[model samples]
Target chain A: DVKVTQSSRYLVKRTGEKVFLECVQDMDHENMFWYRQDPGLGLRLIYFSYDVKMKEKGDIPEGYSVSREKKERFSLILESASTNQTSMYLCASTQIGTGRTEAFFGQGTRLTVV
Target chain B: AQRVTQPEKLLSVFKGAPVELKCNYSYSGSPELFWYVQYSRQRLQLLLRHISRESIKGFTADLNKGETSFHLKKPFAQEEDSAMYYCAHHPTQGGSEKLVFGKGTKLTVNP
Candidate 1:
């Protein structure tokens, strides 16, 4: 079975602290994405990487950054955690294709900035 | 700008009733659409895609270019069908492979 593993299911951090959410996929997908899921806003893309060391900003890339030093792992970073940054973060991976492929998602990390 | 819209924020229906979740998009060219479902305490998963045209778990979606809509429908909704559904659009022409998602609709199938 294909698996996308997130480092944490839940995390709590203090304001102004740095936070890291890690995601690893066993499918050897070339494309990985990070999204923040909110109640009314749904899933807003924060960042995505198509290849190792190549990153692209998404619609809501502010206050967040991503690192893809390796193929199977991608990490989301919060430089300064704030209360407004608290949300459910999801990581997904998909094979490189002509855009007809499905994305497999991880179990999500629910972060709380207190 | 490419955008996907899901008008309904929440939908409720009793078991064995027909259900339809609306999804609309605005893009320049032919769009690639997908429906993703997230069950309670589960990861988000691909429910169906427009290109496949295959029924999944008794659910089907038909793309209408005239109206620019791809609505997910099921003749009979079961209690297990209650979940959060998101509509996404993938840009095939652009070099970017990112997906644009809607605000999502939470379906509640009461027994």
Candidate 2:
């Protein structure tokens, strides 16, 4: 079965500390995305990559960055964690040439920045 | 800019009752809409897409371009239907690969 795996299901980080959330997809999809889910704001896109070594900022890319060195891996980096950054982070993957736009999501990582 | 709005934060219904989850979007170009569901402890997954025009688990959604809405409807609500439903869209432009999601609506079907 196809899967998107996130390294951590739950994480806690201190304020001002750097953090990394790793995601790997076995589907070999060309598109990978990172989104943050909040109570009232829904899922907001943070960043996405359509190709290896290429990335683009999404609607909310303020305090986050992403790295995609390989096709199957996409890493979200929080340079300096803040209390407001505590939210559920999700990773998704989709194929480019499939003529479909459905995204398969990971189990999500619930991050708490203290 | 493209945007999706799900006004109701929560919708509650009893078993066997008909349920409709409202979703509205704003995008000038052609739009592809989708409904996603996330049950407790499960990852979010695609429930249905407008283009497919097919029903899954007895749920259906119709894209009303005239009203700029895509509402998910089910004839009978089951207790197992309790979950979070998200309305998403992908515009013809840069949004084709990335889905823009709205604030999800939590559905509760009491048995």
The TM-scores, one per candidate, come to: 0.97, 0.95
DockQ of 2: 0.62
Off by over 4 Å in 2: A97-99, B93-96
Superposition error at B88 for model 2 (Å)? 0.8
lDDT of 2 by residue, A27-88 (tens): 88999999999988899999999899999899999999999999999999999999999999
Q: Worst 10-residue stretch by lDDT in candidate 1 chain B? A: B90-99
* Model 1 chain A weakest lDDT span, ten residues long: A94-103
Per-chain TM-score of candidate 1, chain B: 0.97
Cα error, residue A17 of model 2, in Å, equals 1.3
What DockQ does each listed candidate score? 0.77, 0.62
Candidate 1 lDDT over residue span B1-111, tens digit each: 789999999999999999999999998678989999999999999999999999999999999999999999999999999999999987688588887899999999999
